[model samples]
Target chain A: MKRRNLFIFAVLAALGSGPANAACSFSNEVPIKVLSAAFEAWKSVTDAMAECGNVQASLDQDFRLKQSAAFAANPALYQLGGVANNTIPQLLNEKRIRPLNDLVEKYGQHLKPNQLIKVGGDIVAIAMMVNTQEFAYRKDIFDELGLDVPKTYDQVFEAAEKIRQSGKVDYPLGGMTMSGWNMALEWLNVYASLAGDSFLNADGTPNFNNENGIKALELLKRASEYMDPEYLVSDSTFVQQQMQQGKIAMANIWASRAGAADNEAESKVVGKIYTAASPLAAEDARPVAMLFWDGIVIPRNISDEAAEAAFRVAMEGLDTEMVQAHNDDAVWLIEGYKPGRLAEGAVATASAQPSPISYPMTIEMGLIHSAIGNQISGFFTGAKSAEAALRAAEEEYGTAAREAGLLQ
Target chain B: MRFRTFAAFVAPSLLLMVLFIAAPLTSVFVQSFFVTQPQIQRVETERCTAGFLEQQCTTEIKNVPVLDENGAVVTTTRFVGLDNYRAVVRPDRAFAALSAWDWQALMSIDFWKALRFTLTFTLVTLPLVVGLGLAIALAVNNTMRSIRGPVIFVSLLPFIVTPVIGALSIRWLFVGDGILTRAMEAWSGTEIAMFAQGWTIELLMLFYRVWHVAPFAFVIFYAGLQTMNRETLEAAMVDGASRFERLRYVIVPHLMPLIVFVSLIHLMDAYRVFEEVVGFRSQAHVISLQWLTYDLLQPDDAGNRAVSRASASAMLTMIGIVILLVPLLRKSWRDHKGAR
Candidate 1:
């Protein structure tokens, strides 16, 4: 009787393993490695890819810092990399990523037309999702205070004032104001909304040191007054937690985090949060946001066989089946993705009159972004005036640009 | 010992020091004087990215690195003497701010700001660590033997924890609505935010460094206390010396060498304060020289890092540590010569 029972258990274990292999249409033979950002969408995609076997995915928040150097190795450390608009330039400029036109033509029958990221008329990356910062707020509190959904910065400030007076939450506003990359992105969003597509001159020198720059700085300072006093340490996750815990009433948070509001396990105020298009900095300008896309790229240093295998596995990961299972994970560009209610803010912002600009994929923009991140905190800390902070950022950008050989 | 034995004993460690420490230091010193940059060219290119419902294409002139025939970025290494250092120190801006009597402007510069905090953090915590450590050693010395072990264990717990983890633990204890902060708020009947300002964060960092390191000082001082000359202490006692008088005249004099040793170690460690800035996430409010170097080395989104500037900052940090140790080294040298 015991031997029969053991034999039956072994049979059951074999049955359990059968479907795991059957889920992927093809059995992968190559040992492929992928490096990507650690996020919900990447997790879903990579897990789907793992079904094909021999795929090792490293999900790290610091993937950008490693991607370029890893891809530049004689035999690339990773066969595939996940990148966004801002992170793809270094790989492109170094000629480290291969053009995927032939691979796409062979195996990308299911890929959408808009999914191909082309530079110099050659497909380089296959975008999976679109992301942007949008206006997220606690709808319950807004209705309780009889406040309308804010469309412009002034209306947002007025609504924030009303919420503050009502004593409904700990703070009337939350922001990704942590003093490095987050703060720099916040500055760019506001600056671009006020002065569109003028980040640099034709010669790659900074061009945001005039009236629009000061106004953007002043607006950020104003917004900080309605936020928590510890705003300088508040990153996206912190602000997301603040919203989920019902501590903050409103924030211009990432669209990727909107699903967390309804996560019953962690959120205290489930279904109480809502999102809308990002508020405009001016009447006629676009929303105060920038569009970003997360995608996969094949590395040039890998052998053609590895690249082909990696691309096929990537396609399997990004198939309609994955999107159907993880529809709300991101604003997926895949065909089967059904944009849920949480995607409304991102969709509305993207389709608005005078839609927001995609983040620049240029070498000079990277230096400028770092310079702004390093120096802009002084304006809010009361250490420097807005003009002085802008001047300092320009000077910092100049130094870095010169070092990078973008400036003489 | 025979000369051959001495050579065998010393050779391995000396070789390791040269291979690990001296080689890297020389590389960094050389790197600080030179700049390696990719050759860049301006080009007009059309790029397309995914939009929500469609694709957005734009044409712009971008600065892109020139790639060689073999698909590697072409780079040029040049000896740019003092340029990286000048970029970091910015003497022109510093002198301008100084001459104008603009303290805020001077502090806005990264190097000067980091230096001010690093110096204060090092100097302020040194005496406190020594004092607290000495006090604990004296208390532990007078305690009953049975309780001494547990007391010492409890005191050494903070030191046993990893430095970054210890800082993070303290941060959680006080960060936003943490239990300690909530209790303090209840006690004071007012709201408090510990990380809302620069000085409060600096104060917390100093407190944490003292708390974490005083146990190390305590263990060393406790060891020194066991070898204390009982006769000298008894002589002071019979001479009608009060407890304070004995401690001042006999006990402190005997512990002076140990104090200097701990001071030298603490100064070297404290001058490179980095974990607290990261664990506390106080980059916006305050920064240290070590953190500044790390920041320069960290790659941005576009994979750009100021490697030469980072090396320069590292060299400056080492120079600072050497200057701080000069006085202590001089005293130790004098004492050694006198003994000889």
Candidate 2:
């Protein structure tokens, strides 16, 4: 009887383990056509949701399905992971991309995972990096500033100053100066312009204490005169909306972010508004931009076949009709800047122009961008002198990178 | 056999406490001390521009491996004795030394100034949340049968709402841009910084704290209040006692232990207020203890372990809490013992 009980137990143990393995072994090789349909569904949901950035965030099952399939097919080809404000973890995890490097070498003919992620992190589409577009003010603010649409940062600033000096508005400039994050981006534009190419070295070391960096600080300090003291802590999007309503003169904001800022129904300044370059302290530097992104990543445990199938499904999802429509309407401003839009309406039309720019992890650029923002916040707040703040910022950031084990 | 039974009974609880609670706590604390590899250090030095190299245009930025006072590599947050406590005592060694971003916070002497106000808030608010909770509990206990469910739930609304949203609702209601703001400006002719002024923050805290806390406190007190004998209250009333005298002689005595329990719990929760203030803070930085603790843990460019500093602050906070609460605990306990 005891021997029979032991045998029964052995059989039960084997059966108990089957369910977990069954989930992992599930097939992800849905055809391109099915994937195209999925892409449309995803795009529709995304447009309707409007606010959510990742499906995994709001819609778990779909994100999981997309992630699992991508992992099953080619785990290395997809996946981007990082913490908010925890860039160090992202950099450290870059070592995990080595298999991906080998995969890119083998599949150089198809797509670049990094560049595709730049546009959007959906399954079917190859994410594009360069996403920007222009917006305009409504009629009322346009007439009040006596400002015609300006093309350059110089023209915009002049218009802003004219509007401010005219005493028509309460707030002169409406832009974020809070959390040292938005302010950090503004600082990056200034540094990238003033410090020229020297602020960044080939391997990603910054030239922050350099004269160009100081010049960038000085420029930010000058802009501080127009900023409200509370600007340092206001929500970035909310501030931009106030600007759209002609509450402030001008705000240099994200292209994807312009939807919330545009007051189509009630905005007096809607048609008169124009998007301009976030200019530089030095004339040579162009407007700086980067892709705010998310991507599907496969956990390392899946089989080779499953991984490849998942990658295919994920890419197909990105390319689908609904997903692209959602991206075009909600996430991507398709006119001035096009991401993965092949189709003009939503899905990328077959004849659409290929996107320019790169995505995923850019370790070197990240190092440069991080330093500029914090340093600039300090400059505007007058926490320290421009020279001293830049100098200290240089030391702190360089050491921080080295200590986080990113820089050798 | 008895010893074995006792051991068996205690072992599971002890093991669980160690495994689930103590183990994770110890691990997080230990992690604060150790810096593992795969961490990158950001660029700390920049080149001098042109002729500026003549003076201090360049100095080799220090990335000296973090060291202990003895100049040994200190990797973990050990019990560094009173060194942490001394940080509070020594103005130079306070949080001001570690964060330059916070350097702008030091211009006003209010960095340290908030402590006096915070203590006053603690002294006032803790009792109010408990006192009001008990009063509501007593009222609910004596309520007509028809309104009991509604009364209990209506009192509990503040606790269920997420504090962030609750604070937000309060802010929209009271803010300068909202209707109340315009009315206040028109009638009172005064500008108010809700987050900057200590009183405004205290009022916001009292409003929200009472809201989130009253329900739980009421439930606890309500359960305790249910056991209150009608015979004792009737005897007091028949003895020619007035309402105030009846409450003082009968009800206050019954509710003393409940008050102590609620105060202890609320005091601990109040010390960790973070999310609400970050959501607000418009003009002035009203630096709180939790905010300072977050600064230590926030990943820096160096990615170095802030374990020692975090551990030290935690230890000091624990001590401060104990010191503040000792008198109240003793007084309450004494009252309990004397009543028994």
Against the true structure, candidate 1 reaches a TM-score of 0.96
* Every model's TM-score: 0.96, 0.64
User: Any residue pairs clashing in model 1, and if so which?
Assistant: none
Cα displacement (Å) at residue B276, model 2: 2.0
lDDT of each: 0.91, 0.48
Per-residue lDDT tens digits for candidate 1, residues A1-408, read: 667545533543442333334468897878788999999999888878877766778899889988888998989999989999999998999888999999999999878889999998999999999999889988889898889999999999999999999999999999999998899999999999988889887677887689989989899999999999989989999998998889999999899998999899999988888889999998998899999999999999989999999999999989999899899899999988887877788889988889998998888778888899999998888888898899999999998888888888
Per-prediction TM-score, chain A only?
0.94, 0.62
> Residue B249 error for model 2, in Å?
6.5
